[model samples]
Target chain A: MKKVQDSSIAGERSVTGEFEILNQYGIHARPAALFVKTASKFSCEILVEKEDTIVSGKSIMGLLTLEGSKGSTLKITARGTDAEEALEALRTLMENKFYED
Target chain B: MNLKKALTKDTISLDIKSSSKEEVIEEMIDILVSAGKIKDRKSALNVVIEREKKMSTGMQNGIAIPHGKTDTVETLVAALGVKSEGIDFDSIDGKPSTIFIMTISPANRTGPHIQFLAEISRLLNDPATRQKVLTAQSKEEVVDTLQL
Candidate 1:
């Protein structure tokens, strides 16, 4: 479990959270797909940052380029009305190791 | 990360005959087998099928990336196939998939597999590249387009 930082400016909501990859295989195809699937459910714009590389959270290919291995840290930022919910969902997914070993 | 080096004419198919999801995947695996990249076709196919069952690799924009990790392969093996007619791959966007990229990697390693996927993803992310791949006339044309 990790803490999510929520902030809003000019009536727009933006939430950012950092999570560690605990799964043995890290963010492989399956985890990346699950992340995209969950992010696609919301209308907010989601961006995933690994190290310094950032890509759309809704894109499987974009996320794959991040090379998020085990123990790596990923920072996800969601901006829009549903930003908070989107981050929460993603946080849960990562905390659960994308439901993988 | 150089796909051009990993792929040959044998691993690239400009015209895919299969119209179903399972058939297309099998056809791609057969291509890899024909290229001598995969040793145990049954195990490779089974892993991809199982992974597909968990969640469709049929991504958005008429593209599908079906991949799996198995001990049957010593190194990462990949194949690219294009179906002009498009097949119903149960894609996330609900569109028929025309571009198929299938990969089978070693079960114990993850680096090379991820790198290969990243490279392919980068190539297919472009609309122009996708169009070229879909409309490619020959395997060499496909290879030239996928070069990165």
Candidate 2:
């Protein structure tokens, strides 16, 4: 639940949050697909970063390339009108471990 | 992290004949089994089938990755099959999936499975690479396109 709100532009709002991957298998294909599915539900743009690698939150392949193993932390950024809502939903998904062990 | 070890020329099929998601997965698993990557075909197929029943592996951009874990495979084993005509895979993007990559790994380990998926996913994420893979003439071409 660690998050920071940044409003650098006049009307653009962006939220950056860090969430640890709690699932036993980390961000494998299933969890990555779930994350993308949740991220795609919003109009805001989503990006996930682990270490120096940043990938589109809505891309399963991109998310897999992140190699977000168990115990790894991912920095998620949501930008645009529904940025906050997108971040909240994504945070919830991570908190639930994508509904997996 | 060695994708080539899991995928070989024998495991890559350029023209898959299956038209449905279930059939295509079976075809891919057969390829893995024929390549000696899987010992028990029934168990491997069952695991993937059950996993698919829970959630489809049909990804975006005409790609479907059906995978599962089983002790029948000592390590991570994978196969690539391409259907140029495309087939309904119930993808998130609502498009037909022409490229399929199925993987089977040991149930006890997660690192190799994730690593293999990460490497293959990253390779296929490129539009150019996908184009090359879908249009590859032979299994060798597919391997070259994937750089495996």
Candidate 1 lDDT by residue in tens digits, B72-115: 98777888888978999988778899998888888898888777
Please list the residue runs of candidate 1 whose C-alpha ends up more than 4 Å from where it truly belongs after superposition: A1-3
For model 1, what is the error of residue B65's alpha carbon versus the real structure, in angstroms, after optimal superposition?
1.4
Clashing pairs in 1: none
Model 2: CA > 4 A from native: none
lDDT of each: 0.87, 0.89
Highest DockQ model number: 2
The estimated TM-scores of all candidates read: 0.93, 0.97
Deviation in Å, model 2, residue A36 alpha carbon? 0.9
Q: Give the alpha carbon lDDT tens digit for every residue of A6-57 in model 2.
A: 7647788888999988888899888988999999999988999999999999
What TM-score does chain B alone reach in each candidate, compared with the true chain B?
A: 0.95, 0.96
Give one digit per residue, the lDDT tens place, for model 1 in A1-101. Answer: 46578788899999998899898887777888889999999999999998788899998878988878888899999999999999999988988889887
